[model samples]
Target: MGLVKIRVEGVSKVFGRDPAGALAKVRSGMDKTRLKDETDHVLGLHDIDLSIRTGEIFVIMGLSGSGKSTLIRHFNRLIEPTGGRILFDGDDILAYDAARLQTFRRRKVAMVFQRFALLPHKTVIENVAYGLTLDGVAKPEAFRRAGEQIALVGLTGFETSYPAQLSGGMQQRVGLARALATDAEVLLMDEAFSALDPLIRHDMQMQLKELQGRLGKTIVFITHDLDEALLLGDHIAILKDGTLRQVGTGSEILAAPADDYVARFVRDVNRGRILLCGAFADAGLIAAADAPVIAADATLESTFAAFAGGAAALAVRDWDGRIAGALTPRRVMEALARI
Candidate 1:
């Protein structure tokens, strides 16, 4: 009926000599040395609660050591949670044994790492088919499927090329193809575009957004970049030290940050770029009249550029050229001032 793919409950992960004990801090005690000395045993994640809807691109963002990676890792059981539960489509993923988990990874969930995890010697087709092969898909069938996936990621003619022959961005595209080949419902991307150069990164971000828009795959995207989060996420969840700081749409966070940390994170952002023309229009500032209009879904950045000569109010007309409302530079500037 609807895609409500990944759901996470009171998930918590702790690395320490006594992981179970570290779930909650105890007073200075007999095992102080054990708790203090072991670094990995320390709690990496607190009681984290989140629900990722199917087909929605949910972004998890935080700085380094904030448990962003750890929290994401828990989704696929790469790192087992010391406490709580993870459910995939109402199934308790934690209860799945190796075979069931392997099946799940193959068919339902796929991950793209920061480092393109393609086999260096394998050709692009071979890399994309690796998952299918592991899942017992026929060699020839897997190869054919891989070819289709390669084409989907815009690596059509390079199917026979090795990972080394491709640029970093291309290699990452290969990685994406490999994941897509599985037809996985949930795509967990851990800083997928962080490794690319600025220009390349922007291209990759746009590509991923386009791909997601077309494929409608549920994505749990992890990133340290606020701009990236705002650009890609349908819903943004800000995590600080393994705890959720705030969760909302990009504009909601930009318009009203839940706390100082989130406020500071988006403080310098240009709201004109982050918010849509509809937000300003809905503020009831625009006087409805026949004038040039931009769609409600258009970005402020794009809409502002349309009014480059400094118009009083650009009419937000519909597709049929009927008057909807107006957008003013003053409203845009006011919204941007909140960031």
Candidate 2:
């Protein structure tokens, strides 16, 4: 496990004219649904507890009205929690006053939204530097830093273009660059790519993965898409009706769903597509004279691609790229047969 970046401890949110009364009802052993039914108050989230790690893409995924969005807001104190505590590095963020919270938001965390919130009047570089500008950074220094981030997101040439003149994908790049420019420890992304076309969304996913490898920034990405969660998340948390359903890696969630709801949600998932080749590799199989080489973490789907013409066995290579084991054809067959 990595160092814990943010810990949400017993966090809950209720939206109503008398939120305290509704919260009291909830704490007095009333159920989430019953509390809502009996009062005008709405339960946005109920007892959400999670430990988000540093330098990993931690995805919060669920369908609409799952309170996925509401939970994330509490991380940055966008919606003050009706109860419980939010700890950032073991300090209660709920205790932060105006000055302290402002500094925390400006320096420690940055957010990216589904709608690319760019200033139409400002050029790409200008918009990218806007956050630093608000912090009293000089124009030349801010733009210099902004230019570097621009290149990082593959927007070096479009720095002079206005947001309206750019394509939706390019406008999103500006948003990403702006977030990166602050060099914040945590990046809160709320449906950052939901508005893009399929191809563009896929490209952005790949781009985020590549960036994470180099920058190593801890990112909390919100999305309602299961496929997107499976692709991008190092670990995932599933939400439904303001309750956290499950939290685990893609494989763990797929192989062992928590309940009927989760099972139904992942029913159509292709097992072979996500299972690593090492999972199916035979430990007893000694290396042959010329067995094909494969990374231990390589997906079984990619393993199949390696044997497009067909193969009897292949050696499993570890992180150092050494042969750790081999995958016999029969063992691979049984696994693929299930799929």
Candidate 3:
């Protein structure tokens, strides 16, 4: 994990008249249901506190009305908080003037919406270059930068094609490419892959992981899908009824939920696919001389096939290829059972 890039501090949002009064009642132990019933104000978020690290994929997720989208919008100040502060690199963004905020939106953060928000009449390159053009970059320079982003997103040959002619996945790629073209340090993706077919969604997820590995952009991704959250998030934050329930790595949350709501939320997740072998490895155990070696980062699901070879234990190697520990069949079974 890198240093904190975006910090959300005690942020609360209420959608109705007199948000301040509703926030006061909320601070005085009133819940969302009560606030809504009494004041006719909807609690969109309550005291959401988080630290998003530099160059990490921070996922904010929940079911409908969980305030996941509302919370993400706060990062770029799309939705003003009823109270609290939003800081970017230790500077309070809520304090930014209109001109400063506009610059921040253009140069510091870019957003990819759930819908492919591309111009139907514009070609792929034209759409990708839209941000730069809006910022007054010359046509030739903007097109050159946009061309690079188009290729980066694997849309090289589709530069001249309009969005209406492209498939849903391709349109989304154009959206992603557009965000990338701005060279913004942070990318806010609000359910970027939710509209694609299952196979295409999976492909886009993999491509995003690969892109993050290379570009090292700080990405804040919002989703309602647990699988997608686990697959992408370096740190996952779960919300319910506009309140933060828990925040941790996927393995940490799967292994130990903070509350009953979170416990129920992750009850059906495939633990073997999320829990890493390193967490279950026995540092004191000795592996057989001829035991199979597996990477420490390998998921428990991937290690099952190695265990099927009749090895008593598999040697787990760290990134540097040194034996970190040994993982036995019994240990794997115990870990899975605990979850």
Candidate 4:
């Protein structure tokens, strides 16, 4: 994890004519269901506290009405909280003036919506360059940057293609390219892949992971799908009923759920795919000199072929390249057997 890029403290949002009053009631121990029934005020979020690290994919996930989308919008101040403070790099963004906020939205953060909000008539390059043009960048410079982004997103030949002419996945690539063209430090993706077909969504997820590895943008990805969240997020925050349920790495949450709700949420997940070798490895055991080596962060599923090849045990090496421990085939099966 990098330095904290965005910090959300005591953030709560209520939607109604009497937002302040509703917030007060919420703080005074009114649950979301009762508050809504009594005041007709929807609790969008409740006391959300989060730290989004720089250059990491932070995923917020939940079912419908879980406030995942609401929480993400707070980062760019698209929707202000009724109470609490949002800080960007230790500076309170909630205090920004209109002009400062405009600059912050344009230069610091970019968003990719679920529906691929591209201009219908605009060509791919033009759509990608739209943000820069809004920032008063000259046409030539904006077009050049946009062209680079288009190519970066594997849409090199589609610069002149209109959104209507492109497939759903291609249109989404245009959305991503447009966000990247702005050179924003952070990317806010709200259900960005949810609109695509399953295969296309999987492809987009892989592309996003690859892009994050190379660009190192602080990405806040909102998804309702647990699989997508585990695949992309360096750290995942689970929300329920407008309240934060838990926040941790996917493996951490899988190994030890914060509560029964979280446990049930993760009950169907494939443990072998999420649990790391280091967590399951035996520190007391040592691997043979000829044993296969796997990274500590490698998923247990990735070691199956080695185990099938008659390797009784594999050496688990950490990120720093030191042998952390040895992972045996029996341990892998034991982990898979765990619900």
Badly placed stretches (over 4 Å) of model 1 are 1-3, 26-40, 282-288, 305-310, 315-326
Q: 1-339, model 2: which lDDT tens digit per residue?
A: 489999999988999999888988988888877877888689888899999998889999999999998888888888899999999888899999998998888778888889998998999999999989988889999999999999999998888899999989999989999999988989999999999999999999999999999999999999998889989999999999998999999878876789999989987777677767776677777767687888888877776765665766789988886677888666666665645
Model 1: how far residue 20 lies from native, Å: 0.9
lDDT of 4 by residue, 275-313 (tens): 999899888999999999999988999999999899989
Clashing pairs in 3: none
Q: Using TM-score, rank the candidates from best to worst.
A: 3, 4, 2, 1
| TM-score on alpha carbons, each prediction | 0.89, 0.91, 0.96, 0.96
Residue 79 alpha-carbon offset, candidate 4, angstroms: 0.6
The runs of at least 3 residues in candidate 2 whose Cα sits more than 4 Å from the true structure, single-residue gaps closed, are: 282-293, 306-308, 315-339
Assess candidate 2 and give its lDDT: 0.88
Candidate 4 lDDT trough over 10 residues, lowest sum:
330-339
Write down the lDDT that model 4 would get: 0.94
**Count of clashes in candidate 2:** 0
Q: Model 4 compared with the native: what TM-score?
A: 0.96
- The parts of candidate 4 lying over 4 Å away from their true place are none
TM for candidate 2 is 0.91
